[model samples]
Target: MKALAALALFLLALHPLSSSAQVAPAYHARAEQLLPLLGKDGGEKDFFSDLFLTAVPVNQWRALTADLRRQYGEPQSLGSVRQNGPTAGQVEVRYRRATVGFTLVIAPEAPNRVIGLQIVGAKQADDSLIKVIDDFEALPGQTAFAIARLTDGGPQWIATRAPDRQMATGSSFKLYVLAELARAVEAGERRWSDVIPLSHKSFSGRLLAYPDRAPMTLHSLATTMIAESDNSAADTLLLALGRENVDATLSRAGHAEADAALPLLTTAEAFALKMPANASLRQSYARASIAQRRAMLRDHAARLDAKAVDIGTVAETPASIDSAEWFASPKDEVALLDWLRRHGGEALPIMAVNPGIAPADAARWKYLGYKGGSEPGVMAMNFLAQAKDGSWYAVTGSWNNPAARLDEPRFVALMTRALNLLAETSR
Candidate 1:
């Protein structure tokens, strides 16, 4: 009897210990099944390769694997795979140098393809890279803002919203239009010096109506449109180019979200629509026939709405603008800036608008240019600057405070902080 009781007690204890041990290995094996296939042929290998090449070293890859093993203990072999929704497995993998701590992912295909990967990090760190994650996981009291800043070499970013969130581009959209026109000149579709007729109807707000017979070159119109944020100049240029051509240009330049059909300007719907504040400009607009003026306004308004608005007053409700499906990812935006830098004289007049570039810095950076946009509740800026060492960066920001009003200085300060953060991170 004594032997029997002792044997039963031992069995009971053994059962619980066995169950606990079994549980861990079961979870670990499941993780192995979900681990991303890391070689060159894998779907996400290129992304990993780029990240590793940019931030880590080839020798470090083995070290990373060893460290993972040491910390986690022996990994279990994969078991009979079971499907979980579209995923075949799931796991959390750690990388020492990644901006985020561990990467949590779900593998949907056999051989464990990555269906999703979530990076874990502090709010600021997450904003610097996985901005969409930050926005989705935003806690109470956190306000989302897009940040753009110029670093010594170029531009960098941190977003508090999804990367694709399309805020109004304000006058910044003019940059795209101007680029298109410039390209047209380059392609022989239009000449920079070609005289375009201006009319009384072309004037609005601060832009005085020009005499109907006045003529200006395409180059002058583009310069005025960007440098001075001249609406009439932009409208006239758009009319000459035609909406279809402008859209085609944007598409060619890789701006898939750009819309070409928006009218030039009207009150009800326009994005960052503006004209010269000069009285003479206003008079020129006022002197035009009411119908002609309205037609001009209608066209201008359409163009503004189509482009997205990122600039203007900082104290009022931003104009109700629709979001765009197209956006420039942080990586792509940087590439575009690099392309512009490589082709210098092509963007001369527009580049000249930036007052921030000093002569000495210009020589060191080679080419640096920036555009800023502000509206009642939105603020944004984009820059492409080259470094003395030949490196370049593209920095951009689009911020909106819809629930409360923030002063311009405060807003600018916020943007400055974002820029500073980029500089600190890059170094």
Candidate 2:
């Protein structure tokens, strides 16, 4: 989803900027007012809204703010500020207890407002896949990287830094729901035009935020789920298609360990699984009888509100990352993309709406489909592209670090390099 992880951005809000370059006065004043509140929570009346406030709701604001306090301790000061774009400047933030540094983006247009944020890393972004991954793996945390191409039959191994292993795939798992829905439509059991009332609601999607209770077509829901990684849309589709059915479909599409996502987690269920209380509950459920698990999950699901979720708990600890979340291998990822290319293929087109690859690179292909997922310690990107000769191929990779936040820009830079190489070589 394009939506920022609330805790990631919230933590950036607390940093003190330190820079060798000149900084705008407007940026300083805005940082002073918002930084203190972001450092430790409590002061709410001081928020100023221009673009960000209008885009994110107040409830999300509070949930994220509270989550950061538990993770980062408290903010100390703004360290340095450097202007990047006419409308963007990066600021460094210092936290009281944590050693990690943050890069805060201040909108040049609204110099008084924060626009983007990221965790800085020792290894800088590089175009070379080898160097990039070398830096990534050499960094203090764990990371797995892989790439594959879709053959006429299935994925062909290209390059990999790790063995064929399943890693946590954030919203990329929604592909399972989309695949099942498309299959049902092709079988005449359902229609793409079938209109269903928005059956669920949650954050990480624009559809849930729609003003009117307009019934959207199944096609529309599927589109937004992949295009925007809409949690509500995915949950709705999961309910309609039957979670078990999607789970089976994902396996048939080549997911190695079907049970890894067993009882097929709804976003709410998955998010709750990250919470200390619910994470324990999930473990108990996993050990319980199959007959009792679904009921137990449903009973707990009834009690959850988005606010009840820590939002940061998914990346809070190694124990949590290992115990509660979705998992997929890059090999399995390419296999699914290839399946969509040949069987009930409406999905790839819907995914094409978001080109997760470079534009110059995209131009080399007849079509491209991209889906990405992320939480605190996790990030994933999977692409399905068609060469001009109508040959179908998929390029996919994932990165994880349970101990700390990811260097999002650098990771993306690394993946983009992979995509660029495929774009150039495929032609």
Candidate 3:
């Protein structure tokens, strides 16, 4: 499962630039026009150009605005607008729940139609650690998080919520695979640049469409596995590194539920078992002992391939998340990060490829290595972050709901707020 928490990129419909002095007011006017339509209906066709509408259909536009309304409430005011050029500028829109900053671009002509709009950042009026905890509790389902501030002696627990309670962690479990790969490299068993044939395939990745058995480097697989949460890339690496070896990472990294995480399933196996067609197989695997489950994976390996997975059935709703998906506590995740920080040399850059937060928030850290994961009803985000003062911290969190889908962006916004608060402390 790919981490579905990326910041939404409003279409950047660029047009020819104009240097007219009238650009600023027209751009501001268009922004003002768009603001009032949020949380309402039927303004997308009138305000958006054919190009914009084509890229972002009317239904998507409606859903985006409605989501804004649901999360931040109606737009209360627009702050000072800073013009980037004749057709571009930025503004802060204050909503009932939060203030959101947006970069706006427009056509260089009369009416100055909106050509692009991107959410750059957001902030809340009563931002605090306590408030962050409160907001986490306010979310619809089970939530766990841990923040540890590092010092010379070691890590000090700064804040936490159910730190020891295990929850489903979508693709975030790939961090352990990364740790094991790094360990092998350090032991001289393999090199990051070592080449191998791409031998596994799964959905939610670019590799699934590539020619089978195409040659690729270990580093390339790790990059896509972490940076994009590529399922195929992950499965290929897991099999190459050896499942038992990767399983050892859990215990070595202080995973609280190592036994529960035993016989870790590849993306393909997970998808295959979760499909409605494999109910009996899923039940048998769930009830089996660790050794038995391992045997089951071996004996049933052929039946648990790409052909067995039904994407439609799996997407219908959350299926066996508690029983089938990766399990980790917030504290366990922090411990894993601590191990990686001390041991992960080459893997650090691969993790840093995706910051997992807004550019403004990510800039607060000297280095931010992030990996997150998500599915229909599960979401998790973890970071091994280094501050400007050479301090290291691990921030990890998860949200899970077995009965319904999750609001990924809403959870992301809350986590981003927590990170921003940490940035203030580091400075």
Q: Which prediction has the highest TM-score against the true structure?
A: 3
Q: Local distance difference test, per candidate? A: 0.43, 0.66, 0.85
The stretch of ten residues in a row with the least summed lDDT in candidate 1 is 5-14
Go through the candidates in order and give the clash count of each: 33, 13, 0
Sort by TM-score, best first: what order? 3, 2, 1
The sequence of per-residue lDDT tens digits that candidate 2 reaches over residues 249-276 is: 8878887776655656788777777677
Which scores greater on TM-score, model 2 or model 3? 3
- Candidate 3 residue-wise lDDT, 1-427, digit = tens: 1111226455777577788887777877877876676647876766777888888888877777676766677878877788877678877788898777777788887666787777777777777988898889999889999899856576799989999989999899899999999999989999999998899988878888999998999999999999999998999999999999999987898898887888778988888888878889889888889999999999998889876677888976898897778889998899989989988999999999999987657878999999999998999999999989898999999999999999787788778888888988887
- Candidate 1, lDDT over the whole model: 0.43
Off by over 4 Å in 1: 1-161, 199-213, 256-316, 323-339, 342-344, 356-364, 403-406, 414-427
* Candidate 1 steric clashes: 33
Candidate 2: 10-residue stretch with minimal lDDT: 1-10
lDDT of 3: 0.85
Winning model by lDDT: 3
- Misplaced by over 4 Å in model 2 are 1-136, 211-213, 286-292, 304-319
Which rank order by lDDT, best down to worst? Answer: 3, 2, 1
